[model samples]
Target: MSVIIDFFDETNEVKEEQIEMIQGLINLTAQMEEVDEAEMSITFVTNERIQELNHQYRGKDQPTDVISFAMEDMGEGEVEIIGEESARLLGDIVISIPRTKEQAEEYGHSFARELGFLSVHGFLHLLGYDHMTEEDEKVMFKKQKEILHAYGLER
Candidate 1:
């Protein structure tokens, strides 16, 4: 399985450790989900940029920690062909670096942990996981926690 993560740092404040952690979490998430040959993009942006995206996409006029945009809605036997590679376009994840830092301090955790949480959370969303409902939240959050703990990024 090949998981390619392209990162764009608009906030210049992202740490090296955060980048490494995001890559590791993406790989681990892909492995656990049995995703072979997938591609995704992660962008670290400022709070203002993320707030604009949040309002535009989600209609929430506020800065969010993370947002995910899935490329396609596929079911059994459904495939999306991109060029000739047959690679799965998992989609994009945008994170607010400023919000992440604030949340880390608010939650009393390291910045790396918060960043990892947001990355894993966004990756799961790209995999069709949702937290809108109670049961869905339970399952999604459980999987996220398990993956993070296994990656040695515990709360």
Candidate 2:
């Protein structure tokens, strides 16, 4: 599996360790989902920046931990191949660094774990997973936990 993660750190608050961990999670998610070739962008922004995005996109003024924009309308358990050398553009994930830090503290977990969770959560959304309903939440959250645990990023 070849997953290209282009990270744009607008906040400059992301640590090197977090970047490595996120890359690992993305790769693992892609491999687990059987996405042979794919590309996605992860952008780390400030709370203010994320709040703006939240308001503009989601119609919520508060800053969210993460937001995902998926390019393809894939069905569940489906992986589409574009080409061998070319990878599918899987869309973007925007994360609020300050919100992530606050949530990590609030949840009483390591920063790495929280970051990993958020990354995996956003990746799952890109893969056509959602938690709008109870059953959807169960499936999505279960998958998220499984991916994180497999990556050794447990709470």
Candidate 3:
């Protein structure tokens, strides 16, 4: 299994260890999910940028902690066929740095743990995991916690 993550910190407020932890979390998420040869992008941004994205894509005016745009998010009866050698192109995950800080303080966890949670949460979204329903939320959040714990980012 190969997980390629292109990380960008537009906020420039992230520490070096935070970056490394986020990257490791993404890789661990992929490995735990048994994804083979996938490429994903994670971008850390300010609340303003994420608010713009939320309003534009999700039709909300407030800033979100993390937003994921899946490349293979297909409609009903829409199928994406790929070969074995082709890498799956998972879409982008944009995280809000300010929100992360607030959540870390609110949840009484370390900054790295909050960031790792968001990173794994977004990665699960790319793999078609969602929390729209109670059952789905349980599944998605459970997987997120497992991956974070495995990566040593447990709260």
Candidate 4:
């Protein structure tokens, strides 16, 4: 199993070290999830850009920490993405730097931990994990905690 990650710093807020850290975190998450192969994008954007995306996609005008666009959505049928070199195009994860900073402060955790949380949360969504219900939320959150702890991104 292999995971290919591409980083785009659209807001110019993400540092090189941060990218390295998040990339490792993502790779660890994918390995833990047992994904065979995947190619996904992680884009760091400004609050304004993220808010616009949230409004257009989720019908929410507020800025969110992260938003994921999965290539293989669970529709009536399904959508299989054929990425470069036969790697599956799992999805794109867009994160708001401002929101991440605020959330890290609010949660009293390291910025790296909050960033990992958001990235893992987005990645889990791409893998079809959701928290739309109480039971599902528990399952998803427990998995998140386990992944984070294993990655050494705990609070």
Instruction: Give the CA lDDT, 0 to 100, for residue 104 in model 1.
Output: 95
RMSD of each: 3.0, 4.0, 1.9, 2.1
Q: Using Cα atoms with residue i matched to residue i, what is each candidate's TM-score against the true structure?
A: 0.92, 0.90, 0.92, 0.92
Summarize candidate 2's per-residue lDDT along 1-155 as a digit string, tens digits: 88899999998778898898899999999888898889999999998999999999889989899999898876689898676667788899999888888999999998888989999999999989999999999999999988988988878
The global C-alpha lDDT for each of the candidates, from Candidate 1 onward, is 0.91, 0.90, 0.88, 0.89
lDDT of 3 by residue, 1-155 (tens): 77788889898898888777777777777778888888888899999999999999999999999999999898689788777777899999999999999999999998888888888888899999999999999999888877776777768
Instruction: Give the poorly placed runs of model 2, Cα more than 4 Å off.
Output: 74-85
Worst 10 residues of 3 by lDDT: 145-154
Residue 31 local lDDT, model 4: 88
Q: How accurate is candidate 3 locally (lDDT)?
A: 0.88
Query: Which has the higher lDDT value, candidate number 3 or candidate number 4?
Result: 4
Q: For candidate 4, what is the TM-score?
A: 0.92
Better of 2 and 3 by lDDT: 2
